[model samples]
Target: TVLYYDDEMLLELKSVVISNCAVGHGGRVIIPTEIKEGKLIIAVLQGEVTVLNTLGERAAKNNMVA
Candidate 1:
């Protein structure tokens, strides 16, 4: 699942498959763009996740703090 927030609203996503995504500010999580100023929280309760950016590069696997 994913969550997003912008200057106007907030969004929550689930069962999403993203390739080359982008995310903006206000906690917005964009798929196929640049991830600007937000936080990505992951909970591996059952499986693992692979995140990719617009550059077709894999996102780092690390704990992040906004």
Candidate 2:
């Protein structure tokens, strides 16, 4: 699952992908450590892939439009 956090709220999103990156792929969750420079850094617990908690430019643009 991806932990989505902003200034207002924290949301737990399961089986999500952002910026062409997959979160909790193959049922493995990369443990989130901290947020830096608009990216949430995660540690590898049992997987080879690392995913970040980023909203991506497209999502940000959409949010701005909305």
Candidate 3:
């Protein structure tokens, strides 16, 4: 769920496959262009990250030589 601070609402994208995630400049979560075309940005403030597999782990796995 992506939170919009402007309206204080949560937007959820269902059945969307996340192709890739990486650490962007200033430690932001960089969503690949193929996924959302740099449209949405989800920010996590004042709370713990609770995703099944984090972006860091996914980025590491993607960078690994298979």
Considering every candidate listed, which one attains the maximal TM-score? 3
Which residues of candidate 2, in runs, are more than 4 Å off?
1-55
**Model 1 vs. true fold: TM:** 0.21
Model 2, 1-66: lDDT tens digits are: 233334333332223233333358576544434422343333333323344454464666677784
Q: Model 2, poorest ten-residue lDDT window?
A: 12-21
Give the poorly placed runs of model 1, Cα more than 4 Å off: 1-14, 31-66
TM agreement with the true structure for every prediction: 0.21, 0.18, 0.29
Ranking by lDDT: 3, 2, 1
User: What's the residue-level lDDT of 49 in candidate 3?
Assistant: 35
Candidate 3, 1-66: lDDT as tens digits: 332222232233222334335767898666555554434545533333344643356666677868
Worst 10 residues of 1 by lDDT: 54-63
Error of 2 at 47 (Å): 28
* Candidate 1 lDDT, 1-66, residue by residue in tens: 433334232333222334434456865555443432453433212223444332212233232423
- In candidate 3, which residue ranges exceed 4 Å CA deviation? 1-20, 38-66
> Which pairs of residues collide in candidate 1?
5-27, 20-32, 21-31, 21-32, 21-33, 22-32, 22-33, 22-34, 23-34
